[model samples]
Target: MRQNPERRTALLDAAIEVLAREGSRGLTLRAVDAEAGVPTGTASNYFRNREQLLVQILHRTRERLVPDEATLTGPFDTAALLRDLVARMRRERSVHIAMLELRLEGTRRPELQAELAAFHGAELSENIRWHQDAGLPGDRHEIVLLYLAMLGLIVDDLTTPAVLEPYSVDGLIDAMVARLLPEQPVN
Candidate 1:
């Protein structure tokens, strides 16, 4: 396996693009190498097998989609946080699409399913902890509700944006926050 961090990251990023564009069935090492404009065997050097590649893609997707530190610097404005999150997701549409593809693939592959379930479980715990640390006015249940609602909104926005055209995305986010965290006044 290669030891170049930059090359490995590049390969994983290329894999993300391939996954988004080709789905799991089409995510071959050659596809990633071509996507990265690298030599034919470069991805194989970085990842031993497709499962390893898929798992690494999950980590890369999370890294790519994390909230910006600047957005986390102020008071716990749920609407603002959600708005920033949604904007990031929209901007990194490929990352989200790749992630969705992995999720669908997970349904058919038990190992991938376990990996995704573990990743999501940890992420959920982190979100809850972050919300508490930020003094956000919501419990775990509310947080989970907001998470589900936002996930649905994001899926719609990314895959079928026209479905949400009648209402402004920001407005919808605001409404979702207001409804979910009734205690926190919507911004």
Candidate 2:
């Protein structure tokens, strides 16, 4: 029998919830089935093994988190992008935490590390394309460095936003943009 697409998505979401709630160790097929309120063997029917399940989760995360072209082309300023990113991060907090769990889990698992690197590389390529489409002023390397710096900001703000409470999100975004973004000279 063919698997239901909705059922597969539900299982993936359940897996993400399990990872967020109980960390990576709890991401077993049994756990996913339990979270989805399905039979014990359902997860196994969909994903061949743990690595396969993780790969699905990563793909689903990118589907939800990757913005469409309109958002990319609408307004290309750093502050606007940061504001949008902060909102998205907050909205997808569970997914973000689950991603962190997966990354830490990847440290001991070579299979996961390779899979994640490939996904990350693709994501970086899309980001570079988005920047070019938006007419952002930076080469790929500079954009990559800016991307890492933004990740630091996102992670810090997610973990202990109080550390940056004095600056306010907008102000901090302005400071980050000022430091990292290339300035254009007046014509």
Candidate 3:
């Protein structure tokens, strides 16, 4: 019922921390309120229900994780771009973990599943368009594969980093980029 933009954003950010710390089963309105340090019913005032909360969190996570425009539009090659992406993910580790939580939760809720699918599908399309428009060395299909590969890399790096203990994240990123995109000369 409240329409304060700053308060709503604060609540959503608190919810993200809750999801990251407690996982989906522990994400309750009370937990969000506690995390936000707001009154008991404050989150309820901002979000109509758990589903709405989850949806809003989804968008908020994307907003938190988006790379800077200069990083994308500046003169950079495909490998550099991928490295910047990995760095961004590492910098926003909690947000990425919370996003992973949402994805797992989506598997159990059909409506949430649809939301995740549509959101990620559109995101993938946009990435492909950006790759082409930016003159990155890769086709749509390659970009799609790269997306899938990086997603796996991200999961490993975030959830169970030990699984990749043998190789650094940057090394894996270089390997993935090499396989997915044509070799570009360094400037």
Best lDDT among the predictions, by candidate number = 1
Which lDDT tens digits does candidate 3 get at residues 56-76? Answer: 999998889788878877577
Looking at model 3, the pairs that clash are none
The parts of candidate 2 lying over 4 Å away from their true place are 68-70
With a 3 Å backbone cut-off (N, CA, C), the pairs that clash in candidate 2 are: none
Residue by residue across 1-187, what tens digits does model 2's lDDT show?
2289999999999998898888988889999999999999999999999888988998888777876576677657867887888889889887887888888888889989898899889888988887877777677777787788888878888778888787787787777777767775657
Top of the candidates by TM-score: 1
When 1 and 3 are scored with lDDT, the better candidate is 1
Candidate 1: tens digits of C-alpha lDDT, residues 1-187 = 8899999999999999999988899999999999999989989998999999999999999999887788888766889888888889878999999999999999999999999999999999999899978888788899999999999999999999999999998899889888888785569
Which is the better candidate, 2 or 3, if ranked by lDDT?
A: 3
Predictions in order: lDDT = 0.92, 0.83, 0.90
Clashing pairs in 1: none
Candidate numbers sorted by lDDT from highest down: 1, 3, 2
How many clashes does each candidate structure show, in the order listed?
Answer: 0, 0, 0
User: What is the lDDT for 103 in model 2?
Assistant: 83
Query: Residue 147 lDDT in model 3?
Result: 94
Q: What is the lDDT of residue 154 in candidate 3?
A: 85
